[model samples]
Target: MSAPVVSVDATPVRAIALILIGMACISVNDMLIKLLSGGYPLHQMVFIRSVIGIMAASVFVWLEGGWRILKTERPGLHLIRALLIVSANMIYFAGLSVLPLGLATALFFVAPLFITLLAIPVLGEAVGRHRITALFIGFTGVAVMMLPATDWSDIPRAALLLPVIAAACYAGMQVMTRKLGAKSAASAMAIYIQLAFIVVSCVSYFAVGHGRYAEGLDSESLIFLLRAWVWPAPEDIWKFAVLGAMSAIIGYCLSAAYRLGNAATVASYEYAALPMAIMLGWIVFAERPGWIMLLGTALIAGAGLYVFARERHRAAPGEVPGPAAERPLRRG
Candidate 1:
């Protein structure tokens, strides 16, 4: 029997649902990184994860018809994207090593705002008064979240800087992804990113010395690594496997969403990951953001949602839109 035909146009509710699932997958990926960090060097963990991802992507390509899908007209753009993504991952993992999950995730929220600013230069997407106001509010939220008025005299300033740098690199990656979208398949982009990460991780790992990897693995760390590697005594192997599967699914959905909608719109929904991450952290790790952090998160989420809603309204027929209409706003 022939496969059933799926609708090309997903309802807004369906798109929102897929997005939420994608966000959950992303949050769980972060949780896994945190778990593995305890037992392995961040570089090694990134390398291993990238290797797994590369293998998974390879299979996907083969089933989809080999090197044809991997072929890209924009190899240079792909390389640039790889570099940005690798750098962003390194910085983000470094930040995660020190900063709490919620805080680190909060800092990473700046990527969307950065993307909004970048759209003008890279994608030539025009920004309007409403988006400008939203951007200001969003940045204010970031400032409040990152530089809160608290006793931070002893904290390493690097903690704050790392995520900011990561966010900037991530924004660049998003812009590049938008540029490449016209010429490449989503699977191709995913393959390039995974391969780039694998190469980067391998280089970083060997340069750092393998002994450091062994040294980093204490009993607790060993247990975490072993669980990840072997799935030993894992009560949640199925859960982790599902998480991995969801990662691939989310990648596809996000690509589709961006293809169908604007990046700024999709990016606005990206902040949805924050509240989910915060709640997960609170429940799983007993972590909680302070009142100020909560307020900042609210601002960020609201601003992003505003952007998303405006984009959606503009995309809908008969809605009076502004500058955003003249240019194509692509996404990662």
Candidate 2:
């Protein structure tokens, strides 16, 4: 009468490598989205990306066994999971448009901490003193990142909360991924995510496609959020296409990584996204991280990794109930 345990491979080398690839793809996708934010609406980009992503994900569904593979026993959970991630993306991308790329991504890295805390309540899991200490350290890192060294002067105060809130939603979606459904194909879950994205983006278009509602907002983040859709530049079509493709790949890989790898082991590898964000920011945006930012990054990544190490050390043999991120095929 219980749900099946996640599919976990003992040596998930392929899963780890695949998720690292997914992290890299996500970092690149985040950069491109930040680049495009100045000229386009978030919803517009999401809409385009989803359209293309659904098409790409459809190929995956087909490969899995035609469209029937998309069917699921838990449509409601799928719907909730999809909306959580869509909200996460919209918030994170809007913040990315204004915040430094490295800092924003680093902030989002606190998602693991959110997972630990969420697991306690939602999964009825207990948090030990060690993880409690880890939480304290993890949050201190967040405060460090928020210091003036990161240049809070130009940032809209509200924008500072965006990634953190996004992180919470992302964490919630992932927690549910572990608890929800009767275990479906990665392709099926992926298709559900893309379809949810499609529906949300269409609703956004109807709500604010013309920018008439954005008449007075001056914050760059708000502008990015409320901006009207303009046709993609001929040259930028490729970026949207790439984002769509990468979005699909990121979702599929994250699902596979969590499914195949020990949740504790695989969760540690997810930190790879922090460094990828830093490297890509340096290369593409020329954003330099000061020592303060570096310290913040170290604390966030270290705290998260340490949590996994502890989980591995203390848990009983067999499958450990570690955090598994599905992005929920979610986040940018």
Candidate 3:
């Protein structure tokens, strides 16, 4: 059977709002993650966040009519997608544990580049010479951005691999989304992924022992890590609730955005998250990204924008088309 197609039209104001809200929620999620990295084990953080996500999703499923909302014709694909997402989260969090928030996030943006390459095989879409050339330029930019630190010998090389691997897994997850298409509910897919995360986190936590929990940091750092496990304070409960609500809202908005515009267009705009994160880091944490990092961000953003523009031009009517077609793949 042919894959399901979502309609793409002029962007809506509400869609823009949804995208912004989604970006903010995701940014906040990352900040919380950064906060928790020092004390709580990454596995524990994954487990807690997944549990919160599942619980929140479960409520929606129940309110939407119980088991039916969880139904899917593609269980195996769901499993694959979940595995990809879980892996991506683990790798991403691991990278976050060591890397600066903005830097790690910048590297993660490479996932779209990977997704473009994967589409050729996974989606059977042809990528033409020009798009391929653009893709190469993009990767070159990514490589430049990924240049080793001046004190590279001081840092463990292994640490650098984590974000790269995470980006690949995330890209795989996005490609699978297109493959799964409308055959599955986005909420169900998200639910199962969280379930997978819970399972993995439980396994890792038991294997590693809770005693290794970040114990030696100063009080301030200790509080940050503990933030992941601690129940929301009276004042903070509303914040967590807002986070969950925002998650659902963003989920719907992304779904709607995909329906209204090509994935390339939507994905291009996603880079907006980077600037937002950078600003958040500055305003909230008094952190500023370095010039090299900014240059790297520019390269990556430029590459993505180049690909996005090319895809849009090709998709436009009466244009001399390239072999690479912009297909809207389901990406969570």
Candidate 4:
């Protein structure tokens, strides 16, 4: 379904519901990638998902207007935006292939901190003392979450960077999205993103999908990157379809949520993904964070919410809302 365009009469409750559903889809997508990461090349999985995602995005385009909405004035900017998001997905999937779900999810929460910081230079947005403090607390939470992990040394230090770097790319995409304004239909944006995935994955497949470079790789992430493309096992085929479908669902719902709901309120609700991710990690993978890590996760969420609140407060009566973490963080 098409997301409602932003209107004066907002339906905050329905927007809240949409955000919950979107986050759930994201959590499922993450789990699927992690599961698939062990067996198939990342490009192979991404190419399949992108192919399916293009079809689903077509439906959204149809629902929004028609194929005509795909037209854009700034093709280069869109390509750059698509590249940023795809980079985020690849890096995150690499990390998720090795890290526990809960820790990875918590690390990704640093996106808000990145957004707030990046906004200043990239968007020329003003930041006050309070929001700055929130950024510090959120990053401190990242350190706190990792500090107590007895097994942290076992993980390749580089593997731990997957979520944070991915988050930075995601935030960069959002900044570009903001600069692009609300001119294009969200579905159109999604289509190009899928296209970028298809092109990039195809290139990767041709370059190294023969497993030539995968021979001596010890890093799970690197092996995942260069491994030969395999025909997915029969049972895993449907899971790939689910990943594509989930991507379309996420694009539509998050777009609709931000448009239809109060930005600050709806953005705060997006934090629900943290708990959802953790719970799914526990149930599906039998992984759970310790109390200390949970506390750190809470701190990260609190800081993000605090930033949202500050954005709301800074938006004087009838003035345009400042940027918060309206991240279209489609999971890897």
Candidate 5:
């Protein structure tokens, strides 16, 4: 008997599943950071995590034909992509330490909008009426999410902007990743990104962490950013390793998902992170998002879905796939 055949159409389903599971892993990683932010400096956490992540990523790179798979012609592009991912990580964590996980994750939802906008100019992808409309609706969602509420006085002003900025940086990284996906190995991309994180974390530790902030700088965000490093307890070493392993997993899954599916389809599935973040926030931190936030999330999801549908419609049978969909994953 012949083995059952898998349809090519199932690629999207596999991509979506990979992305959703990846997001969940990321949320769990975020939860660990949020839990630990009160005690350790952000750079310290990142330094340790990246060290572990590099080790993990290196093993994967080795297993994928012993580092030979990492050869790349576009070293400059890889460096830029690495910087984007590292910057996004710092900004998002800065906001996350203060903002509720759900809200911070919600704000990062604007990444799809940024990605769509970037693609038009950077990749020369065409945008039609439907995508234009989707962009407007998505921005409206961002506006709704950012509007000051009656309780707004309780939240720091900087907290509101950081995650959105992070989202933009992340979107740029995603676009660049897709552009490079055709030639770059997934392990190579991840290894480069992790190395970037390590370099940035070391620089940050020497630059910002050497000078201790005055006492009583206790706002969650400020403390996370400015606190002097503390030596990790023996048990904490294990926790940091786990965090790094999760980061490695996140990098692999995200790279694979984009490599396998169209960017629009993969990006829309990113919204799945919001709900996972919300649940984790509620259970772990007692965060309850207001009704207004829920409305904003709904708008963002609807707009993203519309964009996904439009992208699918634009792809006609037998026509060439765009840059995003054209990249086939190369095996070593």
Candidate 6:
């Protein structure tokens, strides 16, 4: 039998759908990471997922013309991007293990603002009054979300910092990505990230996960970090593999969405992940965000939209959007 031909029209509707699907996949990936974190060392799951991620990335690289096409003159920059990814994922994953998914994701959404701030120092990008105001409003939202009604002693205050720190690291990575711009291919960069994740995961497993124990730590985040290595259940092995596939799927969908549609429009659709995370958290974990947290999320999202709108308005006709304007929220 002959194969059938299939054509995909990259319309606005299709792009939006792709972005939403990518966000949904990312949310599912986060949920799986949270579920696995309870029993396995975070690095172990990351290591396994990276292994699969590398394979998936490899397939894409091959389709794009093999290893030679993945060449980059800027190896050092790639390593830095990888390190940032490792750090951001570690912090965000730790937060996910302990914090409510909605809250953690809401906090992480502040990365766009962080990117605006970092660009001034890292990319030498000019930041005007509007961007500065957005940054201020975004950080205010962070403060609002971080302050619990009862007390800091009631929850692990340190754990709360994880997502904030993750936002910083994630923003740094995005800035680096923007710096590299057309110098590197996105698929090749992704492969490097997966490779870096594997290296870091192995080092972490050997250094801290091999014979470690939580000891007397009562914090969920601490326990998740210091937990010793163990053989994953067979079912979990499958889950991790699925997560690996989802990682690649997310990369492709996000890339396609941005390539097909307006970057600002696609970026807005990325917020779809927040609601998806909230719904998953509620249905799977029976968790709900407080009104304060919800309000904070609104503030953060609004600030992000302001920044996005400003970027779109500033771009000259036919000019490609800057990374800050086009980059979607980093999925943890």
Top-TM-score candidate index? 4
Task: Tell me how candidate 3 scores on lDDT.
Answer: 0.62
Candidate 1 per-residue lDDT, tens place, 1-332, comes to 11122333545555556556667667777776665565456555656565556666666667656768776666787798778877887778766665667777777776666777888888787888988898899788877766644623334656666777787787777666656543455455567777777687677655653444345453432233232222223654444454345445545556544444444445456667787778877776776677767777777667766766677666665442333222122112
Residue 59 C-alpha lDDT in model 3: 66
| Local distance difference test values of all predictions, in order | 0.61, 0.79, 0.62, 0.81, 0.74, 0.79
Q: For residues 21-140, what per-residue lDDT tens digits would candidate 4 score against the true structure?
A: 988888888889888998999999899988988899899889888988788888888788888889998998889998888788888978877888888998998898998899989988
Model 1 TM-score, all chains together? 0.76
Candidate 5 TM-score over all chains jointly:
0.87
Residues 1-332, candidate 3: write the lDDT tens digits. 11234445455555456556667667777777666565555666666666677777776557545667676777777788778777776677676666666767777777767877888888787877866776777667667656775523344556666777888887777777666653444455456766887898788766654544445644333333333344444655554555445445545446555555555556566777788878877776666777767877787667767777877776665342222223222223
The best-first sequence of candidates by TM-score reads 4, 2, 6, 5, 3, 1
Candidate 3: residue 273 Cα off by (Å): 0.4
- Residue 73, model 5, lDDT: 74
Give stretches of model 3 more than 4 Å off.
Answer: 1-7, 62-66, 150-155, 180-182, 211-253, 316-332
Candidate 2 local Cα displacement, residue 324, angstroms: 6.4
Preferred candidate (TM-score higher): 3 or 4: 4
Per-residue lDDT value at 37 in model 1:
60
TM-score of each: 0.76, 0.93, 0.79, 0.93, 0.87, 0.89
Model 3, C-alpha of 137: deviation from truth (Å): 2.4
lDDT of 6 at 264: 72
Extract clashing residue pairs from model 4: none
Output the worst ten-in-a-row residue range by lDDT, candidate 4. Answer: 1-10
Model 1 ranges off by over 4 Å: 1-14, 63-66, 123-126, 148-155, 210-250, 260-268, 314-332
* Per-candidate count of clashing residue pairs (backbone under 3 Å): 1, 2, 0, 0, 0, 0
Clash tally for model 1: 1
Give residue 25's error in model 5 in angstroms: 0.8
